[model samples]
Target chain A: MSDPVISVAGIGKEYVLGVSMSGNMLREQIASGVRKIFQRVERPNRQQQRFWALKDVSFRVDQGEVVGVIGHNGAGKSTLLKVLSEITEPSTGEIRVRGRIASLLEVGTGFHPELSGRENIYLNGAILGMTRSEISRKFDEIVAFSGVERFLETPVKRFSSGMYVRLAFSVAAHLEPEILVIDEVLAVGDLEFQKRCLGKMGDVARSGRTVLFVSHNMTAIHDLCERSLLLNHGELVADGATGDVINGYLSGLNTDASIKRKVSNDADAWVTDVRLIYEGSESRQGFKMGQSLCVEISYETKKKVEHLGFGISIEDCIQSTRVFASVSSIHGIQLENVEGEGRARVCFPDLKLVPGRYMVTITLNAKSFQYDRLEGVRILDVLGQDELGTGWVLSRQRNGVVWLNHEWLLDGRQ
Target chain B: MSSAETTEMPERIIRPKTGLIGVNFRELWRFRELFFFLSWRDVLIRYKQTALGVLWVILQPLTSVVVFTVIFGKMANLDSHGTPYPLITLAALIPWQMFSNAVGASSLSLISSANLVTKIYFPRLIIPLSSTLGTLVDSLVGILLLFVFIFGYLFGREFGLIEVPVGVGLHWQLVLMPIFFAYALLAAIACGLWFSALNVQYRDVKYVIPFMLRIAMLVSPVGYLSSEIPENYRLLYSINPLVGVIDGFRWSVLGSEFQPYWPGFCLGATVVLFFLVTGVMFFRNTERKFADII
Candidate 1:
């Protein structure tokens, strides 16, 4: 085997939590300086806390390998990419790479709004590490891909947001680096444009280039990358095949105890536990796409209650969107008065959620007052397939929550 | 998607570089084209929506000449060393405006372009370096205006246009323009590096700059003649960086009528060099903290 195109040893980045972000005010700094002179002594304040944004992350990717980085918020995925791209320095350790690397931590970087779209294409291209000759050679292709050909002469500030994003993404997509580090920039634009971006990414991956992709879209990662790395709380938890890594990530979420809300001392009535049922057994939270799934909620009430209203709210945790609030009131289910301990089970025989992770919030209302509203009571995962075998993978956020069954109706002589 | 394309660029190692003089000149040379684009974009954007466009370059110094002529020449009766007040003040304002505007813009260059600084990695020096360079276009125009005024006075005398004394000789020493321009450019970049770096952290530099430039113009040899200074305090007054720059411009343009105080010029040039060294040190030291705070 040839040498790895990118080699990263145990690199770490530490962000001083308080000192770095805001020692900015000159007056405060001056005051501190003055106080230092008067005190005639120095001391290390215990408040100076060092938060490691990335800790001891090591990985290597051979040429032509597309590796996906999966992690939750603040999991050091972005920090790792920033370190590799040299946008910021790693506090410790070193990285060696054999090729020129360009990172698209954001698209439309350095685009001047007052400049014409044509000018910005050149400006943004240069900023993204594309030489002038390379951009000039591919100028027509970049404009053609953006589909905003007529507005190229106009200033970009006047262009609609859709046109702006398309042009920006188009310029970024044409950058041909030996190693590319991308951070969820593909999550922009509409579905059709995202497809073009993915297509461009695939073309890049096939041409003996290395790609390090960081994104929350598991389906996109699963469809594009052969290998993946999973990060949890600044540590690399797993790295292997895309399927296995995503499976491990999803199951890790489901089994995590912190997902379940703790006991609420203020509420007279509250939920105790939420369990998942798949195929008529108390299985873990992972459920197959387009299959029956059940969420059985158990709760305890201290005193007698009337007309107890219980419902479950499923939120797309990755997307930060609410999928549904299937309350007993909304679904026309009635409840009896005096309650001590009771269980409510809601099941969908054909749950058509787009495959991703979700957090459920139990909303239990007693008459006019809110008894208990437990957020993140349980984390669930929906596993999907490219059922039509068309190689189109669904994105949980880019596409909506519900997956409607339909067939292509493009006409010929039908 | 072919694998045949190649540039043979060298491999780069990424790690924390600790020291005062870690600036890699080769890396900076590799990104020379980007510096051109950044300065080009700045010059292009500056005149974009203005009604006068590049004409504002000539008009701005003309207005300053008129204003300073009224304030210092007509009323205060400051010595012009026998050159016409407008011509003398214009010569001095040329370098002064170049220094002030470039330094002013560069003081805030990193903040205004924070988006690019945070998202992309190039030599961070390019931001302020480009800002200082952006003023070169205006200086070129302002210098052309000085030439027209000089030859206009020379020719206008033959046609007998009503004349004030034609004190400007257009002497052979004018060939030294590039040397004094080096002084102005270095002074601008030195202040640009210092203020732009500090502005990234203590944004008080932003509020302090414009006010400081106003005070700097009054103290520098812009409105009044440097000959007006007493001999005892001449070297002390040369501590201001622009003292040499403004005096050098007048001596270059107005000829022997306005001789630059050589001792003061040497002192001011030393001061500029001093700040430039410390500026680079401060800039390189603080540059790593920018992407984090900014």
Candidate 2:
């Protein structure tokens, strides 16, 4: 294998919050001045403790490898990317990068609102270390790719959010840096633009350049990256193949099921907890995809609930797209009167979600009308044969999320 | 993956060091087109919507000369060292206004361009440096007004102002005008570096800078001649740094009636150089945090 294109060792970053207030105000200024004159330096008025944004993180990426970094929020994913981009310095550790790096950490990163798009393209290019002639050479191609030719002379401040993302992503993708780091910028663009960006990233990776991609979308990660790293709370938790790491993250999330409960200060009503039970056992823990599963929601009511119906919605976790939803009334199971404390269970004969994380939202409503409801409650991980592997899991590709068992007839001569 | 096998292979294409300072300078040079573009943009934008447009540049110093001539020349009966106070103040105003405007604008350059600093990697110094370059157009316009005043005084013969005898010996040392202007630019850059860095952390620095510049203008020898300063306090006055620059300008243009104050000027130049070097050091040290804080 070729030498690693990027090597990060023991990298950590510490930030001291509220340090800006130490000596600026009039009182602090005079106090500091008096202290300086007397040669009695006061202890640093450190009102805040040091917080580590990243700690002891180590990783290596081989040349031409496209690696995906996946983790939940506050997982040090952005911190690690910032360190690699050199936008922020690490308090301790070293990182050696082999070539020029261009990062699209967010859309419209270096764009000036007052400057026209044409001027900003050049300014953005210069900031990425491109010479004037280089930007001029690629100018038309970038404009065409961005689809902003008509508004080229307009200031970017007036551009729509979609237009801004398109132009920004276009500049970043066309820069041709040896190492390209992209954050979740594709999440903002339209579906077609996102597909184009993904295609461009794939093209960049195929041209023997290193790509470090960060996104919460499992589909994108699975489709693009051959290897992946998982970070949790500033620590390197998992590092391996993309599929395994994503599965590990999902399963790890399942064991710590904090998504079941709801607490609120409003006095009206709230949900207590949600659990899935199957075959006389708590089913929230694990369930293979296409298996029969039952979800139970426990709730508390301030007053009394009459003519109440329950609604269960299963949504694809990654994209927040709802796959299927069924209300108790819609399913012809009605509870005319519900009082103080109760539990409702909705059972699916065959759970047919593809291998992915799914969120179940429980809604309570009055009969023949709408009422107070909890939108999203418990989350479930559905494991497929490909996810569970052949050794320990049954092969059930016969039926999936969609049950389309129709046969098509065609003439052979055509 | 054996170490021996890897060692046997040729060394990877390691990028050259590109010394930190050299790389920074080269980056600035490569971005020279942007610098010119931004400065030109500033110039065009400044005058675009104005009714008088570039005439304001000439009007600024001309009006200031008229005001100073009334207050100091007529009302106070102050000594101008035999030259017209209008000429003296106008010559001094050119450099003084340039220095003030450059320092004032450049001080906020970084904060105003926070979006650029946070998103891109370029020498942070370029923002302030380009701002100073933008003020040069205003300075040139002020200088043109000064020449017009000089010609008016020569031919119009207003207010007992007469053209000097033609054969007066010219000082060869006056060729140091560019050197003095360089010192002024350095002083502005030094102050700009200090303020821009502070502004990134404390945003209150933005408010404090204009007040400081206003007070500094009243104290500097811009509207009044340096000769009017009491001998005992002249040295303290020269410590302001622009004293030397204004003195050098009047000496270079208005000729020998205005002698360069060497002792205080030299001390002021030294102070300017010290501030510049230290400013560069402070700016370099704080620059790494700009993206994060900004």
Candidate 3:
């Protein structure tokens, strides 16, 4: 087999917490100098602590392989990428690569506002590691792709934010490095422009180049990368196929206790547990398309309250777009008098979400006051062929976040 | 989508190194285009929307010359070494303005470009270097204005409208003017590197710079000629790097009694060299933390 294109061994990064001085350089310099002189007489302070941002991260990727990295915020995803791209030096370990690597940590990073769009194309392109000759060769293609040809000579400060992002992304896409490193900066522009960016990235992956992608969008990760790595609190928690890694991440989220709201007195109510039920059984949060799904929320009320309201909100996890929100009052259903520990279940006959994760939020209201609202209470994963598919298998062309129920008619023509 | 399209480039290994000097000149050479663009951007932004535009460049030193001529030439009666006091101050102000402006701009370059420093990766030295180069355009304009004034003086004499005790003419030493101008830029970069690196951590440098520049102007030969200094302290005063630069400017343009003093000039050159080397070393040492702390 061919040699791996990128290799990392025992990479670790440590950052000191709150020790670096921010204000008054001259005074800080004098204080540090004095501290150095009195080092033998004094002990280190409590604030001078070291926290590792990454710990013993080791991985290898062959040439032409695309890998996705998934993690929550402060999970060391950015730190790992920064270390690999040499933005910051690691506290320990080393990395070896076998190709010219170009990282797009941000779009429009070095663009000057006063410069014209045509000038910025060359300026930003060079900052992204493209030589002058290379930018000139691809100048026409980039301008056409951005579709801002009419305003090419205008200053970037005059362009709208959407136009600016489009031009920046276009220049970045034309960079022909052997290995490309990208962060979550693709979450810009309108949906159509984002689709084009995905298409361009797909083309780059197919053209025999290595790619390392990091994002919070799990659906994009699942569609683009076959292999995945999951990081948690500065450590590599899982490494396997994309499906299994995502499953591992979701299951890990379940271990943390349910978030409880603060109770001012015995009269307040709070949500205790949340679960997803499928097929009349205790399902572990995974459901199939077209199957009946229900969100069960358990809560307790210490004092009796009248006209208490219960509601559920479901949001598409990948897009972070709210898909459903309804309250008991909206349906004209009001409960009166005594309340105690009980469970509220909201049912959906057909789960229209196309194979991806959805986040369920539970809310409890008493009269006009909000008693408690638990966000991201449970992550619901939906699987199977889309409901609109013609057969048991779904094609990539028909992929979307939602599966709408509709029919098409055809007419015969001469 | 063809496998044969990949260009051949050298493979690089990245690892942590603990040392004072770890410059990657090859990597810097590859990013030369970025350096050019950064300076070009600075030049464009400086003159973008002002009503006077590039005229402000010439106006800055001319205004300073007028103030100095009134205060020092008429009020204080300082010596000008056989040259007209206006010409003396203008020549010295041209180079001095470039030096001071380059230093001021470069010292603040890292802070002003905080977005690029935090989000991107390139050699950190490029920031101060490009900012220093950005002030070169104004210096060129200032130099052209000096020539215009000199020609105006010549026409006034040819028409017999004015009389002066001293002879005014260009000399062979004028060819060496570029060498001295380059020294001014080098000294600016040298001092700028020190302050810019420190300014990232302690913002006091921002307030400290303009006050420091005011004091620096008084100590240098901007208001008077180097010949005015007592013979014993001439070498001591040249220890300030700008003294050699100002002295060289007057000697190159006006000639005569303002000949270049080799001993004092060498001492000033040595001081500039010392600042340049130490400033670069300090800057490189502190650069790795800028992205994290700034």
Candidate 4:
């Protein structure tokens, strides 16, 4: 496929945690020499530790391909981009690519606060490898796209956060590099600006340039990329079609039991385990978007309890907005007068959720006081089916966290 | 089956090297318009918030001349070799102020813009070079004030209160003023390259630089005339590069009997060139670590 425009082989990066001292002065050199001489008897303490931020990562992207790198925090996504961009050298292995690269690893990265917005646009463009004539030709288009034409002569330090991101993204997207590497910078601006940025990225991809996008939002990744890579704890866990890799990543998250439980030393109660079942049998770890699902919460209590309520909540991780919550009282299920050890099961006939990752939380409470809560007990993946039609899709777009059934109005003639 | 497909094909993609040593000077030259904009921004911002505005430029060297006249001319009763102390001191102070200001500003240029250095790729040398150029505006203003003072002195004497001496005609060699000023600028640029490179790795260098400049000012023959030194020790005294620059300025402006001090000028020129080359190499070597460390 056209010699793979970008090739990364066995790339790894190591960083030292503490300060490094060398022979910066004559006295320091003599002191270090004396310490080395005395090392025959007693070794001096070295307070440095090494961490591998990225390890043995290898990937290839064909010419004019848009690839998405998806992962949770600390998954080595940024380190991979930094190495590919050559901002820093990899500790081992090698990478080879052809043509010019522009990396938008950060918004407003090289902007001088005292410089005006118009001035910084040219400066940022040059830093991205654009010539003066190229930036000059595109200057008006950038300013107009950013919607900061009225404040063009004002110093960027005075611009609001939204204005800053708009200007920053405008300069970056218009620079016209052969390969573009962007990392979550689009998440900053308002909704309309974000949509514009996505549209611009789509245009750039369609124009035949290679793009490497890193983000936590699965829907954005699925919408933009045909091929995707999933990173898990500095390892390449999966790489393939966007849907398959995303589904595989969601399933892999369900099997991690330790990650579900919140461990606290001073807690009165804590969740120990969580499981999902259906029809009296352990079903596939997750459910379809509108399928019946059962959840079981197992916890330990340090003291006897008289009155307590068990509850479960579903929340969208990206937006951190709670979607649906139910308490034991609402379901007519309560465990009281005996609470030394307990397990509670809650079942929903049809849990309506679009195809995305949702965090399930378990909480135990006595009236207004909450004894304990497992912040994120389990991650659930709900798939979509055709029976719901485009109505369900509209609801999914309106509120990404949950899917609720509702009726639509008709005209008087109908 | 015979219908032609209307699908569009994807464009070609290319990737280039991102190493600091691989900085494309051609690209920097291509972006020269941005450099001029940044340099102009620095010039404007420098004076924008100041109270006295551009008047501070003329006052800086003039006030220093007054202080030097009081301390050396009146208190120490130093000889000006038949020339007025104010005229001689003001000529020397003009170039000295420009040199000091350029070195001080350029040395901290990298650290001052830590936010910009880590995020983007530009020729890091441009920061210091632009800051050095920013000081030229102040030096130009100082030069204008010096011309006014010379005109007044010549006019007042022509009105007959003071006798005008013949054969003390202004020498055409005064055109070398620009050359001497260029030499001083080169010296400042050389020191800037050294300090800015060092400041990136060790922040203590920033604090130590002002102290070093203070000591240099005392020893650089700015307040005292080079003629005060014994003829035998004059050769050793001129080893301080500013001594030759100050002697040249005073000789050009005030028509002093002093010679051009070509030996001192040659030594200063050699030292400046040496620092300039080595400073550039050192700056290039340390530039790779700036993004990581900064």
Local distance difference test scores for all models: 0.84, 0.75, 0.83, 0.76
Arrange candidates by lDDT, highest first: which order?
1, 3, 4, 2
| Candidate 1 vs. true structure, TM-score | 0.83
User: Residue A192: error of model 4 in Å?
Assistant: 1.2
Q: Which sections of candidate 2 miss by over 4 Å?
A: A18-46, A257-316, A320-356, A359-378, A381-414, B1-56, B82-84, B151-174
Docking class of 3: acceptable
Candidate whose TM-score is highest: 1
Using DockQ as the measure, name the better of candidate 1 and candidate 3: 1
The candidate, 2 or 3, that scores higher on DockQ is 3
lDDT of 4 by residue, B234-261 (tens): 7777777777777777677666465567
> Candidate 4 on A1-414: residue-level lDDT in tens?
246667887887777654442313434446767977877775434434566888888888877789999876678898788777766667777787765667888987768777789878977776677777889999999999999999998998999989999999999889676678888877789989989998998998888888999987776788889999998778888889998987786666566645445545445666677777766667455677667788887777767776678889887654445778989978666667654566778888877777766878888877667877766557876665564665544235665655668877888888
**Clashing residue pairs for model 3:** none
Residue-level lDDT for B152 in candidate 4: 67
User: Which sections of candidate 3 miss by over 4 Å?
Assistant: A19-25, A28-44, A256-315, A320-356, A360-414, B1-8, B163-167
Models ranked on DockQ: 1, 3, 2, 4
**True-vs-predicted CA distance for residue B100, candidate 3, Å:** 1.1
In model 1, the runs with Cα more than 4 Å from the true position are A34-47, A257-357, A360-377, A381-400, A403-414, B1-9, B163-166
| Candidate that would win on lDDT | 1
For residue B95, give model 4's deviation from the true position in Å. 2.6
lDDT of 1 by residue, B107-183 (tens): 89999999988888899998899878887999989999988988888887778984647566578769988888878
CAPRI band of model 2? incorrect
Estimate the TM-score of every prediction: 0.83, 0.75, 0.82, 0.75
Better of 2 and 4 by lDDT: 4
